[model samples]
Target: MAREPLHLLKTVYGYDAFRGRQAEIIDHAIAGGNAFVLMPTGGGKSLCYQIPALCRPGMGLVVSPLIALMADQVAALRQAGVKAAALNSSLAPQERTAIWQAMEKGALDLLYVAPETLLRPAFLERLRAMRLSLIAIDEAHCLSQWGHDFRPEYRRLDCLADLFPDTPRMALTATADAPTRAEIVSHLKIGVENSFIAGFDRPNIRYAIAEKDAPRRQMLAFLEAHKGDSGIIYCLSKRKTEETAAFLNERGYTALAYHAGLDKAVRDANQTRFQREDGLVMVATIAFGMGIDKPDVRFVLHLDLPGSIEAYYQETGRAGRDGLPADALMLYGYEDIALRQRFIDESDAPEQRKRMERQKLDALLGLTETGQCRRQVLLNYFGESHAPCGNCDNCATPPEMFDGSIAAQKALSCIYRTGERFGQAYIVSVLLGAEDERISRFGHDRLSTYGIGKEHDARTWRSILRQLVAHGLVNVDLAGHGGLSISERGRDFLREKPALMLRIPARTGGRPAKAAPHEVARGIAPADRALFEALREKRLSIARAQNLPPYVIFHDKTLVEMAVVRPRDRRALEAISGVGHSKLERYGAAFLDVIARHSP
Candidate 1:
């Protein structure tokens, strides 16, 4: 039993060895110890429990968040020659009965279920009758209110601890801040000693942010480099998603729209298409991408600002899950921040929650406005330290900064003189001494601070005010009017006359240059390109015939390895990564034939 996990890794999952703390986490679970795992998305988290369930006695029970996610995991497990089943609302009556019988007979290795189903009285009674290996919870952060994606059903999961006191319980998630981790620990009754913090850093993703200037054109420009690649464009609204999808399709790109308003069948079909097909861009709102398992997403684009840094990290983390180079670009403006703030203010949440939301929004804005290393700032939020990652836009093209002490003072004075009633455009107009009718009507033209900002263009001043808002020196009014007012911090700065440095506005749309070509194409030798494409076509054909996503059979990374290694026989092929026993027995010959034909 001790050596079974390592044996299973090489024979079943086809990996040379465990990564990070996976060996320890799996051993802990197998030894009937509770555990908490906070690994990044592509950090081989599932193996921690999957290997344990196989090594231990009886069937393992996994609590998952979404039906689609559960189904995907179940499929992948079954493909690996494991006896896995999912019990959810999507299962037919006969299918559910079969699963129950399988569980009762102890013939199943693992079962994936939602909290709603697992907490039912009948379900709990049936489960108590059977010997269990362990109980694992995926996406455990959903149990906490501080978590970005909170679900009420997840809060009731702690009851499992009492119901099965002897059974080991493990909670796993890819995203959680310190506070959220604390809440999860408290809520689930998991011991603090079992917590494993596997750092929040996805080095394969290149982060970039640009102010929204001609958003459609900017989107097109960014997409130009990513053409014929699978990506997701996240919009702020459902209508915007549809419009963006249509815009892309009209310009000779394959795109689809997804949101909560769509019919259930349509949504499911679109999601399935996005998963099974390559080079299809999914233009969707926030409602679309929580549980998607597509591993080869080449990029993730945010058309507007997300609510918080946690949300941004989770969304962008969805890309580059295959450990390949992927891109994440965000297009934002001052209006997006105001809109997000208005949402927080207008919600029915308590005052405390509203304050927390504001702080989260400010942190996100700081990420967008920071002239320093974006990855460093992001990792610092999660209580981890990383050197300036050269992958992000700021690290690639560093922003120039200038002293703006007097400029900030003048801007603050104009905001105060205008009675904090005008938005940014009006304030910028007054600073430039525009003879507009609204200015004369408001009598703001007579203010002493007017025209004092003529040295900087409106773009520069706008950039200054944006940073000011991000730095907490200025606040946007919550009435949805976009009015700006100084905070206590701004007043302190005015009194102290401290020097401030602001980023100079980039004139060329503020976007990094196009990312390099696909990682696989750039990685393999030119002679091997033909074999790589042929192997990809073979994988796609098998995937389509089996009605599974191409990645479920083999990730592009694995295919790239196959193309480079060019193994000659079954023994040599089995030595390649991702060629587990089940996969080798099933599809090894087909790939080997392609390699043989193309070998020179």
Candidate 2:
């Protein structure tokens, strides 16, 4: 327990100093205090617990949420010269026996287990037999029943405190609001005062949200700039996941689909390829990112709106984990927002839960239509204060703001006039005097509101109504064919005629995303792009030879730094950021040869 964490970070993980609060967290956990940590992805959360686990006396037990995450983490740790293994259902008979023997002999430094495996009574009894050092619960937000990634097994982990009262336990998650944090504290039985909230702003990830117009075309346009990079595209449904993946693959992009509907082996393989290869895009539902640890994911795209800000943060946080510039683009629309609310309304979840879900959706929708900086609004949700990040889409080009008070009044009047029983499409058509079957049958065209909104087109009106829903002036009633219902706020607005400003998306060109900034900007000057690719090829070859993922051999960031520094000799190569003593000793000469072959 008295070992120095900075020493472990240097020799073991190949870093010099702790990035942010990692040193503080490590110190806290090493001193045998029950610690709760909330850190964003790519913020070096693993080291916070890993260092303490190594410094402490007994074996460190990490309760991870996903098998892929466990495997990836264990592999990365082993590559960094630490003894780590995962005990999940995926292990073979001999593998499990080997871990058990290792545990009995006090040979493991860090061992990861999934909730399902860790919660079994037999497993708990077996763990009781061991001299436990620390219990680290990664993705501890799963303990919150209200959060998106809820797990009942996580609720059972509170027993660990009762089971081993003296063992220092740590709960860590990238996403958790105050309520969820309270739940984690209550369920994990950890001290609320001991909790640490790391900064939620991921400045490395540029946030962009676009209205879903010609989604595949828009998605294609966005993907054009991201060719030859790894990314994730999230769809709302399984069918969409497959179709999107196929469509992208048909267009010559390396893409794969993953969902619970797919066979487990297929899901596993798709995940493995995404984890191990470059330039592969995973088209998946929410099922994909619970525990993914790929460090070089260049972007994370959402084809549909996420249900909550917590989910959006966690999913997008998956990108740029290596402290490099990455992108988060989302394409959403009125229907997408309405559809999410419809789900929440239709669910049998408790009334209080539904209210919370609706509020969460409203918050996310506000981000989409907000005129303020996207980064500012998002960080505000996590209780972190940040200036407008100059890099986000809003900061790059602010949305046009017009006096939407009249438009808001007209839209709310329309919802009120329609008996609040028809969906937005029908309402828009009624406004446009479409004379469609629904409009004609409703005989609501006779109303003064009808055809009065003809000043704006149907699409514009739809956008207005969607923003109205986002503004909480309108609600979606799923029981009535996704009808737009007027809220009390809407009624009050109608009565008061308040001045409202709505963000209007630019009609056309604003700014085109640069194509492959990582390669273009960082790859310029001393780092000959050709040499970097050659170095990447060499690293890939070594990874394949060792049967390890390419990043395990050396992350993309490390290779880029090498090309930039152009370390001519073995000693200089050892000074690179990710090149630890063991890594430098093991693969230093090969990388040095590659660097030397293409030295400028």
Candidate 3:
């Protein structure tokens, strides 16, 4: 007798129910309905297609970008005791022949292939002869030219629609904005009504960003709080990534550098270490993490600014994929902002593209400098409405602010009084009486607002100028010698000094105890801490024996549920989510023994 999708969910995957849009998507695909899914990272997007593949006829085909990502998932799926295989360039010709035999013999349940492989006429012709259950395109945003991770091969994926018009096709991505979503829908020929747009909030992650003051020390202090945990520190350049990794290694953290410039063997080794080892940190550039599948990463720290909010969101989303509590911190400064601007200016991209990139950069900068709740700004960018998430730095510490109406008026007066031809530094210099050669040559030292703003320091004025630029009262003419020019809003502000407030993030001498891992376990009962640790210890033992990463055995979320419910036996363990039949038969009794030993 053929098992239903729900039965496979219970007996195979050991989940008692569907979360978010899982059941709907699975049923639609099983019944041959197309969909475009917009779910958050760590939100169980895999189940949407995995379950349908199990219930429907023929092999389920997944098209993905990275070979490493496909390999990780294939490992997990095989561990679940499913017949899955990947055919890629990495496999030898003979090994590929074995995969072909499995497909021909109907022994394979799912086949994961790359876009380049799928696009080959020989492969497509063979696929046409097979009874395909469905086709799923993972990280579907890569198909859009506007996306940061855009791949030219993904654009050819539209061929799937014409080749398999009747097969239920789905495209999935965690980082698609509205335009990208539309592009994906059009490209995949999937209807908007079939789209499932889930909430973008990763409430388990606590967000924090600090102005880069003593950057190395600040990063050291941050890393000190998360000692012996899996984290990734992102840098903009390859050289900076190596330097930061070496610095952390010198300071006693197990760290590795990963970048495009590294030797291929070195890159592969570092990535493997980051995945398999428990406490090693990877200091890498944007090239390091396109399809990272590690689930236990406890934190993601950025040493410099990211290119866009979408890029930032996607990079930080890589952390805490197991649904455990995690931390994401970023350190930004004026220099980082200036450096990013220079990149944009020097790019040979089209003028319109550069203009859009500038807007994206400005959006990220606003989020960094915002005085309001961070989560609100972050979610609203993805078109999700969220209340002030109390877990973020802004909601937790709530940056202090002062009435800046008078100060803003003075700053605007300084810009106008200096002929608006100068940039913020020069304007600020005239305001602070810097007595620079440029200032003296321009004779700006004799102006009325020259020394009137001397009450505030240069940094404070710079912050004010940033806020002005953020609010559109001031525009930095990037093309016209990078001078500061007053917009109509600045003129209106000068006409009527409306109330303006500025935020001041707290800066302490030493890193006060930031949010610890234990502190982040907000919803977990205090009593379950010991049990959770015991479960982790058990998982670690099993993982070590198998020589696999701990998450491949079971996620932290699954263990957390066990600790909460205190499942007594195999049946109870089956009731717990994430414990499939193979896993329950393999480890359920062992876990039950641990729970019994601890239970009073």
Compared with the true structure, the alpha-carbon lDDT of candidate 3 equals 0.84
Poorly placed runs, candidate 3 (over 4 Å): 402-430, 434-449, 466-501, 505-513, 516-534, 563-568, 589-600
Candidate 1 structure quality by residue, lDDT tens digits, 228-307: 78999999999999999999999999999999999999999999999999899999998988779889999999999988
From the highest TM-score down, the ranking of the candidates is 1, 2, 3
Candidate 2, superposed: residue stretches over 4 Å from native: 415-426, 429-447, 475-485, 509-523
| Estimated TM-score for each candidate | 0.96, 0.94, 0.89
Which of the numbered candidates is closest to the native, going by highest lDDT?
1
The number of clashing residue pairs in each candidate reads: 0, 0, 0
lDDT of 2 by residue, 252-291 (tens): 9999999989999898888888887889999999988888
- Name model 1 segments beyond 4 Å from true: 1-3, 435-445, 477-481
Which RMSD does model 3 reach against the true structure?
3.5
Clashes of 1: 0
How accurate locally, in lDDT, is each candidate?
0.89, 0.85, 0.84
Best by TM-score: 1
In model 2, where is the ten-residue run with the lowest total lDDT?
A: 509-518
Worst 10 residues of 1 by lDDT: 511-520
RMSD of each: 1.8, 2.5, 3.5
